[model samples]
Target: MTAEILQKVASEGLPPTRMNARRLFGSFSFSHQPPYSRLPNELLSEIFLYATCRGVDDRHEIISTPIAVSQVSTRWRNVAISTGALWGTIIITFPISRGQISRALTWLKRSRSYPLSIFLDFRDPSWDWDLPESAHPFRWQDMEALIRLLIVHAHRWKQFELLTDTWAPIFTILHYSRRIKCAPILESISLSRCNAFFAARNATFAPAEMKVPIALFGGLLLDCLREVSLTGVHVDWTTSPLRNLTTLEFKYLATDVTPTKDQFADILEACPNLHSLTIIGRGPQADSPPSSSGSTATNRPDSRSKKSARHVELMSLTSFTFGFNDMDYALEILSMFSFPSIKTLALENLSNVDPPALQSLDATPLLKRLSFLDVSSDATTTPFPLSHIISLKLYSISASQATFSQFFDKLRNLEYLGLYNASKDVLEALKPSSNVDFNSSILPCATLKDLECRDMDPETLLKMVKLREAVSHLGHVSFEFSNLCPTLRTNFLDAGIDVVVQTTAQ
Candidate 1:
């Protein structure tokens, strides 16, 4: 009967009566079924939550994962609706419209009483000032509405991030949302101006000046806040709580409001538990000395006086990054704070500074990972006290072979080395001499295991690899080149070295 019914249904469409088709299918005992069909509602809900969690950055998944899973079956729909955690995160990407705003509100509503993690990004390509005014797609009303909706549940916010090209809208939102004085659960806040347009154009753009200092939550303390990141935005630091911050980042801040040595010293004094610090752009000038209040004696060997007051010490700081156009300003800032626990250090645009400025870093003996970006050849002449560094990365830097050989020799315990846009002389210096015995010549980085180089001669690299292997077996080598020699690649592989070669397009 089932076969006859199936044949009739295939010859013609399903019977005009839906009941007859339903009855026919119900009579068949189908052994083939989807695996997920047998999963319990609890397990299915967990799977949906995992899928949403994994693709938080993907706009399509953020909007459709829960809805798609719910549509799979009636049971799934119920399960998804009941699982509030799946809808707790509301990520609103750029080019947002009324529809997206409405959907965002709906998702938040579905979250019920679950604590929220919200990421609102207004970095649309059309929003760039370089584009025509008519190209702008966002509406002030829509933005205000979305901000209002999120503010309504501000007390429940656990993580909030606002990224926009303009600071006006954010300031306006905060100004109007004065009632939101407490976010008891809020732990992290990141507010920054979008610089993607400038980055894409490879042009530097001046930061827009603000008429007033920014303040959040009516200048009240956020007891739960632990991490704060601000870029190109000035805030009233005196009123804000800085005592409990574990991670703090300030980048491209306006010169007028940038913290001076004393002000930054006060901040360091406030945050005794700070672990990571990143500073970029021009910091406060060192013309003014730090305050005498709570200042401690200098521990640096280069200190001029035994009783000279130094800036507050970051007792728990582990990582420090300095990137700025003025190397003098960076060095001056470094002289203010002493980080006894610093383990990782990154210096960008060091080429602008005198090599002696880096010598101030002798205090950080625990630094294990060191990175140099756009450092001048002369700066390499100054022997940095990075003997403890196991990993070194050099980018867009030119140095003589002798300088590189000497620098490499200092890193006796180095294991990983990365060279990008390296000069020919540097590569040649790294290559082992044919006549020199491996044990006799003090080769640079004798303990080196992994080497990464970009835009260098393949033959030179091959020789260096062979020489290094002769001394100490290199485990992995990666190269990015406009052209790669097959013979060289094969030779490295034949020697049991892991070789990765990527050809760059012209």
Candidate 2:
């Protein structure tokens, strides 16, 4: 019988026998698959939801999560397709093709009744072209199509973000969207303009020439809207919905146009529950037309300013940021609000303002984080009474050692200190004198734990670190410099301080 079998194997080619053996092995492997594959469908669906729900801003992940998970096996494919929440976020980019629209429609169908988070990015890279006068680079058709499709689901919009290079598309969408009276579940709306640098550099390019208004959503009100961000886009404060907002940001406003003081105050008054506010003014464009004198009249304090003294108290506001090219303008806006609960304050570009503005800032004792960018001692004289401040950051601030020492003296509870573009005098003040006793020195921030400095003198920094270590306060020190001596780093490590050195590019 063995001889007969061997003869049969020899008669038939070895490939046929080998194919059968491989098939048998594959069947065995499939039957005894990994333990995870044996997980119940319900648990697997939950895992899929968790994985797809995170990192919402990652466009690639958002598009690939459902497809990749479903491709694993027939069972997973069914489970993934059945999970409606996995397809809730739909990001539509500009230059939209038919295929992309189809995919978006499919996602909408799969998402079912889940509230949608729609991000419409109309910042076409082609718009970056420095073309001649006869050419216009915009995909108006594509933009209109995408906006129309999204408007159909207006009631389901949870978050709507429109990013465009020009204001035309934004206005167009808002104009058509006014028909939808209420977005019952809408929570956040962010409308921003791209090509800001281009617009800033080109004085001849006028956004107003396009005949689009700055403010949008005139007659429509989103009762559920909690966050609104507008960048380089104006809004009619009186007509725009500004209630129930928790976060509001306005950046790079038009130079020729701005909300009047009263209008701004009224908007804040309407949002009694606001918690965060950021406003950055647009600086003058080079060689551009000068703004009319009346442009900033509302922000200026005249004899009639007594009528504008009614302040809006923001009791729930905890974070506030104000940046402007004009010191008076910044002060004017600041004078409108009294934030008693503010814990974080950032002042930018108003470096040469009067000391009175710094003194005018309310909630000094409650301030835990303070940042001064491009500030000068000429502008800031009155030291802030920030006894509870734990983190302080200063950037491009030219101040005398006495001024820095005076400010540091106020931060008795400071733990983290960061200095960038610091002047030599500022660095010298931070260097503790070797002759002075650490325990008895009048230096401030006795509770200092972390120190970060850029473009600083290593020797001076080392002295400061030693001083802090002597007082048993130093924990970690990071420096950004062109080069550092290896021995210096080893010395810090020997002192039980975690030292991080980032080499700067030449």
Candidate 3:
């Protein structure tokens, strides 16, 4: 039977699921076969819907989800063809040839009245040149025509994601999608063009010549929109459909092209129900570029001209990630919001900022329920006022023994701690004190039950975990190591500690 199964797989390929074992077994059957076709149309249709959405995540993973199900058998085909929602999640790559449009339309038609989720990737084209005899460049016209087809069904779009390396396809989409008056049920939209690195490295390659912010989706009514993520894509924040967002991310924008501080303030005011927010690269820019006058900020470090920021209270936001390349730009946005209900906070100073670069981040006034903190900073002392943080992740951080002890002293309730590229002094501070009466903060806090470290010294790790285990503080430990001793893992396992070891590339 095993030989038969292998032989069949070696010859006739199976469906993506490869679940039809009874049929594959051929002649080795039970007294009665289960009535798979006895399932009601509605139940079968629901199964088909599940099959399509859960297919492959890439084309190597994404291609065979629905189509493979439909081609299984006549009964399966009929059932799948009757289910419109099964075809609603459309994934297409651009530069569509002449024949691909008909196929795309078939899927669109089969989708019927169901909501659509479109993922269009026009990244690296397979080929832009077809014929050597004549000038047959990549079918920009055909691609635009395909987008036009998609635009015609824009009313059904529930989720749309368009990503490209160049900006030309985005322009094409924006131009054609203007006809959409309202995506009445569009829930999430992501439009990204990752050409910022090129723009920064080579000043000559400017997309749309760095055009002014434009109204996205032809100023359509996005009453049902919930999540929006834009990277290297300019949109008029003041007039765009940015309100009522549960998740909002704007990244990889230039200072000149970002929303102005006033506009961003209005955006925050409008998004009262926002839950998760991320702003990286240059955020809302000040009226004047901070670097125009050869200064870090408009207000000098000595002048203390920190104007009262237009504060907005985020009562619902639980996860907030903000990284900045410019000090004034970072402060300009940080001083504006108070994340009173924030649970997960990630602060990243992308640049080598000066001492008072994050002075505007007075977390005491903003945060009240922060339980998870991930910070990428090179500071001697901890920045945020964290009282309830149970999980803490530090990246690219180094602190002295005194400072490390002071920092750990504050995280008395910290149970799970992760360190990546942390300095040696930070580790040395974790050495347990011999004095049993010594305060936990004076030593490594014994409250820690879980530890995760990346690219750290194995010797230091073993000693630290062993000492902490002696105090019965540690129950679980996860490590990412290039080379580790075999007995060390065995020893920890024997000690009944939950050990998770991940091997990194040499």
Residue range 108-157, candidate 2, lDDT tens digits: 99999889988887676656445532244444555676777888888888
Q: Model 1 over residues 334-430: C-alpha lDDT tens digits?
A: 5466665655555443222332233222111111112222132222112234556566665444545655665566567777777765566657767
Would you list the C-alpha lDDT of every candidate in the order shown?
A: 0.62, 0.64, 0.63
**For each candidate, C-alpha RMSD in Å?**
10.3, 9.9, 12.5
**lDDT score at residue 500, model 1, on the 0-100 scale:** 53
Worst 10 residues of 2 by lDDT: 360-369
Question: For residues 1-506, could you state the per-residue lDDT of candidate 3 as single tens digits?
Answer: 99999998879976744356546764544547358757887898887666655654653233456777778778888888888877777777655555555656877898899998888776655433223312324334645866877888888999999887655666667667677876899999999876544212112224445365667787776999999998777776766778888998887765557776678778777888998888866656654445322223323432112444456777777777765444444544565667666555554434333322332222211121122221322111113445455666655454356556655666666677777655656577677777745455545656777777776766677777777666556767777755567887677566554555555342
Residue-pair clash count for candidate 2: 2
What is residue 132's positional error in candidate 2, in angstroms? 7.9
| Residue 344 lDDT (model 3) | 58
Give per-model TM-scores: 0.71, 0.73, 0.73
> Model 1, residue 482: what's the lDDT?
55
Count of residue pairs whose backbone atoms collide, per candidate: 0, 2, 3
Name the regions of candidate 1 deviating beyond 4 angstroms.
1-38, 56-63, 126-142, 173-178, 196-209, 285-310, 350-388, 398-415, 418-443, 446-463, 480-506
